[model samples]
Target chain A: MDSDIRLLSDLAPGQQAVISAVHADEALHQRLVALGFRIGRNVLLMRRGRWAGPLQVRLGATDVMLRRAEAGLITVRAA
Target chain B: MKRIALLGMPNTGKSTLFNRLTGSSARVANWAGVTVDLASAKILLGGHMAEMVDLPGIYDLHGFSDDEKVVRHFLEAHAIDVLAVVVNATQIERQLPLVLQARSLGLPLVLLLNMADAAKRHGMQVDTARLAARLGLPVVMISAKYGTGQAEALRVLAHSLDAALEIGPARHAALKSVLSDDVRIERETAEMMAEAVTQPLLLPEQVSDRIDRLALHPWLGLPLFFVAMLVMFQAVFWLGAPLQQGLTGLFDQLRQSALEPLAAVLPDFVRGLLLDGVYAGFVTVAAFVPLIVLFFLFMALVEDSGYLARAAFLTDALMGKLGLDGRSFVMVLMGFGCNVPAVMGTRMMRERPLRLLSMLVIPLSLCSARLQVFLFIVSAIFRPAQAPWVIFGFYVASFATMILTALLFRGRFRNTEPFVVELPPWRVPTLRQVWMRGWLEVRHFLSRATRFIVLGVIAIWLLTNLPAGATPGSVATLAGQLGTLFAPILAPIGIDEKLTVALLFGFVAKEVMIGAFAVIYGLSGDALAHEFARNMNWVQAVSFMLFTLIYTPCMSTIATIKIESRSAAFAALSVLWPLALAWFTSFVFYQGMRLFIGG
Candidate 1:
């Protein structure tokens, strides 16, 4: 992965980043977009559960929890 | 009547606004997709009756998800007079694209800036007039939670309905210019937010964030969740016990003073039917009303506080291991209250396979009805100090069965949707909302389960008293014969003929199992305990509780599964799978304990 593009799952808890792209299927991609995870939106990695658990991310005023595999589909750059 | 639909993104207080406008107590949580189906009620707007439909929350009208499809199909199928687009004012930027999409559909629309109080608290000043002018629609700012601008919104809706009817087909032709691609829609929404919404440049930490810092902590969060659940269970028992006891005593008094006197005037069979059959059965299930109410109260509080989403967040990984999602975890938790609603709650999941899988596992959740039976057995078999742990063990087993069932059946279903859940801002639950929810749930329970319970009791009574000469509930009666027929199937699990008869009645409702014991043994309270102690050892008691924990779901749940899944095969599998699992589990427990303890 490029320096500016890494999986959202790789972001440390409490780290803020901007979503570069969401590389998932049409359904998942649309869901992410519907949830305000559109390109260039600032997302904060709020919390990561233990043992590779779901990653809680904040998009705008909304907070969402996504599984690690799902989070891995979103590429982001550190903000 | 004109049809006005309440449309909004998920978690935007659309259902709450609907409740406020229509006075219908549809389930409202601080999370998304609580209203999974279309709910409508007739409301008097300006002294004119209009049917107000509460559509499932959707982010975009063009979206392909189940809820979105339902909303789209509803709009396409029905002639909606007005579209009330509810926007969470605090997140207006993210919500505007949907409003734009609805605008493109050229329905006479009214934009409701809901949660205006929360918006102000967040230091957001939504320029509703400018946005309304820009979108060429009526915009009303309202706080659905506090009923601040609902009347104004309704007035606007009525005016817009009349105005749109005046404009008629011309508006659709002119609106073609407004319809654009997603990119343009996003751009327009961004520009609108920039021009209209004013917020603090640097947002300060919110109460919800502060709480989530601790509640969602990877290490402490899980334990805190468990402790919170334990407290809820304890509250259910501690708060409910006194009320339960009082109700029981009151019913007993009523049976003796009010019902027993009927024996002098009424015939013997009539007295038996009224007092022993109807009254006993009703009271047995009715006594758990307090416990069920408290359970739902605690659940409502947790759900309203937004902790359920966090709990889902915490459990998603583990649930993913079983090919389920975190929302499924929440549904299973709800199953502890009742499997019927929990199965219905599966509609919140957008995916078909996940919904079906969730429906399959929910019945094994050891609902409050089954918990009542276990509580009876535990109180009778174990010391008071040990009773909580014994009950907790059953809960643990229930959770294990839920997870194991999910894992076992995962291969049968395809995993399509990924885990995605919104964490709504935590709000202090109001007493009125809590009371209304608890009351509604209790009412629902009574309406759905009571008829079945009474019918089952009448049937059992008839069976025990039949053939004219057979002793009631004795080995010679019809019930006894039925019990003997099922006895061999239950014998390996250490259930005798009497208990077999009780389990058979339990198929109607689990709470009836305890009542069946009372009727068959002709015992209650200490006498019932003494009888159980004489007939069964501790190992058998443990095995019996385990068997009850995993056995076939009560009759209502099976019917719900059939209706909800629209498949009789799914319902049959639900029953057969649990019965087989229950038998195997109890057989193991009984054999293992007996081998070690010397039966």
Candidate 2:
């Protein structure tokens, strides 16, 4: 179970994960936290951009498109 | 008058509700960022007048985003009798934090459950009275789009403000201390939703998921995006072009039937100024109104359908590499239709540097007006078979110019802003809503930009017509003299004296270029083509079109950039930057041609 941890950017399309941690610069993390990407929250990767673009993820009823580069800041455990 | 302000996260029909209350056509669409600035109007509430302010949407009142700052500043400057927080009934869980944050401000508050009809269709229900009792604030459910329960909502808002007016502001509670932490606020929202809302396990999100499966397919998505853009702009052009032509014809007929008879009563100078200088020049720019409205209307549909945000998601990586975001890409595509509205469209972007940089590159989009110039010149010079290729070459050149401009100035206008966007669910906008959206933007453009463009036209008219008795646009007038003065410099770029005069006319509007040539060479149609051939060869024609592709945008664009950026220096830079690029580009093309082919 501990080995299942991975960056959100690594989750393939249709994979669901629980956010483990979000580490980024202050502003980026603030935005992430504001959008409900916190520890223990479930995130479903509905789809992602081609060539490592933004990732389209759903948090509860909200869908957010976060850049892949920024998605790297979010670590999640595959569920 | 007492003031009631609307606040909520984006796309909650706050502006639509404001329109219902005030009967003012403020800009409203499904996108998250249309209301970059606030719009307000006054209405009678209870027995007195009260101002209704529609603010740019904000996720959190305490958040430090640009829209939030605008909201905070409004609160600081004006005393709000009632802060009506409008939230989508379907999005109560995520939207509740904003209402709680506003509650800490201690203002008399009314929670509006807007879009109740859509929420019911999607199987979400809000218990308004229970929520009111739990939070100690009035909660009303209303459909802003369809005006359902508007009267009830109005009555509640009036009652809340009536209570507020009886008792003045309650020391405007200390803003900093009572604010709840993010975790606590989120927990409170969850508890409130549990008590007062019934959200079905499954709603219409499945429909969006089904659509996005194909729309966001890795392989099919990019091609779909390109095709959608082509169809959209083509639709705008083909549909709006006839309307533009009709307006042009109507103006010409009006001049012929209405003004020509007055020719005998007024002096020739007054008549020329009124007819040729003012009427002709302004009408040429005015003919673009149809295209501008169509652009806003179609863009509203794309936004209302929720694909615009997905488009951003799809293109962010590529556009990011070029130092722009996917939002900039849409505006640039819009530039193919017209540059003025495209430049205006940059207001959707929040960051100043990114918006300004997008403005710098948008004018290079080879708008349809420039396409008109290229079409005539390409047909006049190149073969029928080679014509399409030559025109296509300009499209490539236009993109090359945009990329280079982006890359070159990306560092100068660099911003380290994050690119996080919320994707709203898809919904079809009503035809009346779409029509109102288009008309409001058109009215905004006409009211603000018309004065400056008319002034610029008059300035050009004076330059070409001064020194009475001198022929219009001839060697003796100021325009001709200036053209002659610039001819030697433009010579390295393959432009001559008469062509230079037309270039000057083009600054007023690109569509004026053909008429400028007819005026200068005293020819048109086939005769004009023969004269054009005698003036220069195919190479010169290519070089000239290249110059026009990147040169200074028309007067209206400059005025819009001035209005949008609010900086005269920035507007001056927009002009000088392109002028320099055009000169350098054409100079290299012409000189390089002579060196290689000795043509």
Candidate 3:
């Protein structure tokens, strides 16, 4: 399976996965790296909200909301 | 002191996060790109001061769209302390691309995994520490709703600010190894999001789906939609009454106490300018203020509650049938308040042809200014009960003109892009946001209308006062000469020479249409409405109003179209096409109705 870090939202709550792909351009790639998304991160989904928008997850000691459309591009696997 | 930039895709809780952090509800929703400009505020985090810049939501830094360029420019110019890349935890795969892109900017980054509680309920889990180590940055899980994990996110954010962390250029090579060649680092941000989000669970409470089943259905939906539109139209006039009366009375009193006293001290020319031009202009404009308020209040309610999007979806298929994009519906609804903003709102349509096409058709959308004209004439000529239906007829005429005109245009230049819009999640609207938005709309109307009305009234006063001692209908009088020129065109519509001129002036500013009619008819035996009724029968009065409603939009609206569409020819076409249709429709209605009713 594709392990794009952006696709962490595809996993069910408590399901863990590793990012397989980053799926974007040079500038975008640099920006994402500066934001902490990189190859080989173990991403976990913590919860989902209305319309699959504003999803929460544990990335380090922080949580974030992910738009569903954005979440669809990432390829991941069950851990 | 430190800085935090709240960045995310449209409707990804960035605003909610801002609200949570700043205690200001700056319009958070499930929809995307609602914030057009960056809004910033101060906050204290982890014993350090900070300024939070809430940038507009965008998918990527492609900078193709105007909004995208704005975000990119802001990021490029500002020397930020830390980039707080907020992402929806439920959809991390897609959200991560933006995160990764932001991280690659070589800033100290702290990824906020917001909406964690909802993700957990849906059976998704994320490991923060491991992901942070992998990404080589700090990450925190947060539920902007439940207020969980905010402190941790703030602490991590503060730490990143102090560290001045920077990602090396080799990160792109690392990203390429993870995804395909086509999958750039921008796409990498959301890789984890794609893996994390599950499909939404089905529920019985899908009101939009239920509404769409009927509202988007081919045969029944059109007629039902028409009926619903009629009800809303009727409701505007019917429900807007008490408030109208109260406001009018207040203005009337203000005119007596304040303006009348000021008029006394001024010289004759100045008094006329102050009293007739300024004060009277205010009264003319103020009468419609309540109507604007009520219309916008309802519109705000519709907007905040997410029904406006559903309406767009319901009408998309029909609009497509008419060769208009679903986005055009938004511009049209805005037309009900004013056409200027309707023209500006056309920017939301990305497709060029559709944007131009919508701009061409929007001025014909029967704005609230024209509604005042309709109400003025209808109340004077027809019975109260019959008035609603008469106004309803004009509303129907505007829509028909739009449909027919679009059909004609499409036959010449057709566009076939499916309106693939994502309906935002429904939210329980907060009254604070609704009222603030509503008040802003109300303020816009008041300021825009009053200024134009004052100038228009002064010009009308100058024209009437000119060719001294000349009565209306005389060749020497400027107003009379203009009325005479427009007379032949309006004769078939059964409007008098004076009213013909008034209607022509109406194109300059709709409020002036009323004030000119007032000056012309008020000079004679009665009010403009009564003079209209006395000169022409009820059928003709109704026809005259219908003509005004469907005619060219006011001067400001035309100018706005020029700016928005960036083509003078398109704006000119918008004017002439509608004027021709307005004439033809009025002629048919007046002639056909008179024969049937035996006028």
Which structure among the candidates has the greatest DockQ?
1
Give the top-scoring candidate (lDDT).
1
**DockQ for candidate 3:** 0.06
| Cα error, candidate 2, residue B32 (Å) | 31
Ranking by TM-score: 1, 2, 3
DockQ winner, 1 or 3: 1
TM-score of each: 0.70, 0.62, 0.59
All DockQ scores: 0.36, 0.32, 0.06
Q: How large a fraction of the reference contact set does each model reproduce? A: 0.56, 0.53, 0.00
Put the candidates in DockQ order, highest first: 1, 2, 3
lDDT value for model 2 = 0.76
Better of 1 and 2 by TM-score: 1
In the range B1-599, model 3's lDDT, one tens digit per residue, is 46678888765676567767875312221213222334566777767778887776678855345456556656554556777888888889987888877766666678888889978998999999999999988889999877899888777777776665354436434433433332343355467558886433322346644654564344565567567667766677888866666776776678678877867877876676566655665565677677777777767766776656655655654576677855787678778778888888878666678887888778888887888777767777888898898778777777788888888897655764433344454545666767888889889877777777777777776666567667634556787777678778887788877777677678888867766665555331124456667777777777788788878889899888888878888888888888888888899999999788887
Residues B207-266 of candidate 2: C-alpha lDDT, one tens digit per residue: 878888888888898779767866775676668767866887888788779877868599
| Whole-model lDDT per candidate | 0.79, 0.76, 0.67
Off by over 4 Å in 1: B1-205, B523-530
Name the weakest run of 10 consecutive residues (lDDT summed) in model 2 chain B.
B27-36
Q: Output the lDDT of residue B521, model 2.
A: 54
